[model samples]
Target: MAVDVEAPGLTPVHRELSRAYVEWLTPQDRQPFRPHVTLMNKATVEEAKAALAELGAGWSAFDSHSPALLLWRYLGGPWESVRRFPFTGRAG
Candidate 1:
């Protein structure tokens, strides 16, 4: 499965955080930092394309800001939410 890296959502802060995390993992298990939101896993390219097309018809883009980071751990199959790190920066 592959993820499509889009802009705005893939901000500078996220890139930095991803870089830090990838460094902790082996190159075989992890890859160079690529910003994207995972739509689905283990999907065929044709299926993904169809889904993207269908989704785009009714999709509306909106402004967003990263407020927190969620950490999840995979047990055997399902992932469990472990922690959340909220961004705490003063506005100028």
Candidate 2:
């Protein structure tokens, strides 16, 4: 699902983290950073639309905490967790 980096909560940490790693990111990834989490892959258009509709119907903003940063590598169909960097500071 898509996330507003400018929104309240864990976004400030995300924005700061992105800036900290800007040198490693490509131009497209650096500028205009639009944070989002991929929930599904390789789904058909109809299936995606249906899923979006179903999910969005109950979507709402809520407070959350980013206890750790997870690094993942896509291995064909499944993804592999590379590492986890735990957050040592507080965030809303």
Candidate 3:
């Protein structure tokens, strides 16, 4: 699954937090870690498309809400650690 953040005018605190996350990760483990809130994960292209369609149908029904911090962990061979502050907010 792919995620994205749509914060146009980020506060300094948010920016600093993002920077800190990148700095904390090793170079090989770094990607463009943008601040975002992931609502769901779809396994297939069809599933993703269906989810997008549903989101579009009900997009305007929900009120805006402030973002929050989320932490995640990745477990695998030769690499097992926790990733704190994985997301801050969702893209519109």
Candidate 4:
């Protein structure tokens, strides 16, 4: 399932965070992390298609705040929150 969304003003902050993770994190994923907010997961393909269709031609943007970076461990239950590292809001 896939939906495309944009963070109009966060390109810089995302680059900084991505670099920090790549440098300081012990193990990293090989896939270059593209910053996107997930819209659907664990849903059937048809369901995803229907949901995206329901958005009509397009959708309006909204305001949101990112206060923290969450760390999760998947222990069979899917997500177990291990930590919430609040964003320092510091530029790289």
Clashes of each: 0, 1, 1, 0
Best by lDDT: 2
Local distance difference test, candidate 4: 0.69
Error of 1 at 77 (Å): 2.0
Least accurate 10 contiguous residues by lDDT in model 3 = 61-70
**Predicted candidate 1 versus true structure: per-residue lDDT over 1-92, tens digit per residue:** 34445665446765666667865765644655566567777888899889988887887656556687788887889999999988677421
**Alpha-carbon RMSD, candidate 3:** 7.2
Please, what is the TM-score per model?
A: 0.60, 0.57, 0.44, 0.61
**What are the per-residue Cα lDDT tens digits for candidate 3 across 1-92?**
44455655555545565577766777644655465556665457887788878776766533354454445555653444454443445553
How many Å off is the CA of 30 in candidate 2? 5.3
Off by over 4 Å in 2: 1-31, 90-92
What lDDT does each candidate get? 0.69, 0.71, 0.57, 0.69
Error of 3 at 40 (Å): 3.3
